[model samples]
Target: MEGLSWSASGRDIVRDVDLEVRPGETLGLIGPNGSGKSSLLRCLAGIRPASAGAVRYDGQDIRGWSARRIARHTAFVEQATEAETDLRLGDVVALGRMPFRGRWRGPDRTDREVVDAALARLGLTGLRNRAWRTLSGGERQRAHIARALAQRPRCILLDEPTNHLDVRHQYELMDLLAGTDRTVLVALHDLSLAARYCDRLVLMHRGSLVASGPPGTVLTPGRLRGVFGIDAETGHDRLGNLTVACRGVARDPA
Candidate 1:
């Protein structure tokens, strides 16, 4: 995406956002509340049209592609679900196969294999037969991701994917994304997780991009304090992983 902008009710929600996500790399989008992270993801997924600029897929304008073509290239897992469907988990995951299926045709052998593989990858095979509504929050989130993976998309866009997951599951999900060869662009609130898992980070503030680079460079203490209004120190662990520690900050005098 280049200079991508989004608006709702005449208000610019995302302004001139430039991003590039390539295969075999993970790009973490981090920001404080209302910094346009979700809106940006929506634009990238083509769910929300760019009000000002354009989004390109493989050097072609995305506006020239149909919805099905876009779906085949990008899979989106949103932050929340409000649907009341009582479909079984497998059925929900199998919905991803619709794009690849012929009209009036059921899932073929390849579709079934892909669905099953996605289920197993997300550790949801045990609940494949259970009603989606019966699963826990974390389970539901994982199931949504499984559905996205079933699409066999070249890129995945996730919005707060770790929101309802436990610590173990959070790490597990990040590891899963990191190990995949597909491109991943994820909105995350957990700065530590972003730093630990993503190859690059993009920080946003007030609907504009503030920083973009490797975690160690973009997540500096000064940048965090300036954008997040929190004082923090950053360092490396024994394995040369970036680590963050919050330190007390002096309040600004009015």
Candidate 2:
């Protein structure tokens, strides 16, 4: 996106944001609450019209495409789940294949195969026949992701995907995202997980981008202290991965 901007009720929620994510790379967005992370994702997914600038997908302007066309190229997973239907897990996942199917037609063999594979990929095979409303929070989140993956989109936009997941699932989901060949843009609050999984970080503050680069460069002690208002140490772990530790606020002079 270049010079992207958005507003509502005369207030600019996002301002002149410029960003790029190469194919197969995972870019993590971090910011304080109400910093416009979710708004940015919504704009990128074409759910919210940009007040200015344009969003390009595969070198074409996304504004000209229909929602179904956009779904073929990009999938979005919001922070919450709302299942109004008694749809089974398999049926929910099969919905992702709708983009590729003819209108009023049922899924073919290839579509079923894709749904099955997606279920297995997310460890949802055991719950394939279960109703979506019966699953736990983490399971529901994973199921939503599986539906997105079933579409085989080139890019994905996720908002707080780890919200209800435990520590183990958090790591597992991060690992799963890191291993994918699709380009991923995710909004996250867990700075450490962002450091571990993201190839790059985009830090936003007050509706403006504060920093953008590799985690090692963007998540510096100074940047953390300045943007997040927390004193933190940054270093590399044994595996050469970036690590951060909060050391509390800086002391004031007497």
Candidate 3:
């Protein structure tokens, strides 16, 4: 996206921002609460129209593309998605294949295989028959991710996908996303996870792009203090992965 901005009720929620995700890379979007991370993801996924600028996929502007067309290329998983109907877990995942099927077409062999594979990937195969309403918060989040996987999209845009997951699932999901061939743009609050898994990072502050680069470069102590108001240090863990250790809230200089 170039010069992307979104406004609501006469106030800009996402200010001028330019961002690009490299193919087959996991890019982390980090910011303080209400810094417009979610809004930026919506604009990039083309779910919410931008008040200005353009969103392009492979250099082609997606200004007028149909929702289905966008779905075929990218899958978007919001922070919180509720199902009105009490659909089965498998059925919910099957919805991802809708972009590839005609209105009247039912699940074929390929669709079933894809959905089943997605279920197993997210470790939800055992709960495939469970009612959506019966699942716990973490289970629901995994189901949504499974649905996105079933879409077989080239790119994925997820907003705070780990919000409801446990620590183990959080690491597992991040591992899966980082290892996948699909381009990933994920909004996250966990700085350490983002620093460890993401190939690059983009820090958003007050609805604009503040920093964009490798994890180590973009997540410097000064940037963290200035943007997040936290005094933190960056270092490599025993596994050689980058980690952020926050000391505390930033204190005013004496």
Candidate 4:
């Protein structure tokens, strides 16, 4: 995206933001809430038209493509969502194949196979026939991700996929995404996870880009204090995983 901007009710939500994700790379977008991370993502997915500038996909403008056409290449997993309680797990995942099927047509053997594979990938195969409401919060989140992967999109855009997961599941999810060959663009609040899992990081503040680069460069103490208002220490752990240890919140200047 070049010179991207978005607004609502006469106020700009995202301003002059520019960013790019390389093929097969995972880029983590990090910012405080209401910093336009979600808005910027929607524009990239073609769900919301940009108020200014242009978003190009594969060297072509994204505006020319229809919603369904865009879905073929990008799958979006919205933040803080709850799966329908009445629906079976498999039924929810099958929705991801919507882009490839005719509306009037029913699921074919291929669609079922894809849905099963996605569920299994997320370790939800045992819950495939279970009711959605019966699953725990982490289970539900994983199921939602399974639905997105079922689309078989080249790029997956996720808005805080780990919001509901436990510590173990959070690590598992990050590792899963890190190992995938697909291009991933995820919004994350956990700086440590971003540093550990993402190949690149984009830091946003008040709807503008603060920094964009590898984690080592982007998560410096200066940027952390300036952008996040936190006194932090960042370095590799004993196992060589990047880690961020925060001292405390920065007090407002007198």
Looking at candidate 2, the ten consecutive residues that score lowest on lDDT are 1-10
lDDT of 4 by residue, 46-141 (tens): 888887777777767777788999898888989967545688888889989999999899999999999999999999999988987888888888
Candidate 3 per-residue lDDT, tens place, 1-254, comes to 22222222114677778776778889999999999999888877788877777777887777899999989988999996766677998999999999999998899999999999999999999999999899998998988999999999888889999997899989999999999989899999999999989999999888888999999999999999999999999999788888899999999621
* Per-residue C-alpha lDDT of model 2 across residues 98-133, encoded as one tens digit per residue: 889999888999999999999999999999999878
Considering lDDT, where higher is better, how would the candidates rank from best to worst? 3, 2, 1, 4
Candidate 1, residue 172: the lDDT equals 95
Error in Å for residue 240 of model 2:
2.3
Tell me the deviation in Å of residue 161 in model 3. Answer: 0.8
Q: TM-scores across all candidates?
A: 0.92, 0.91, 0.93, 0.93
Backbone clash count, each prediction separately: 0, 0, 0, 0
Clashing pairs in 1: none
lDDT of 4 at 208: 86
Off by over 4 Å in 1: 1-11, 248-250
The Cα error of candidate 1 at residue 74, in Å, is 0.3
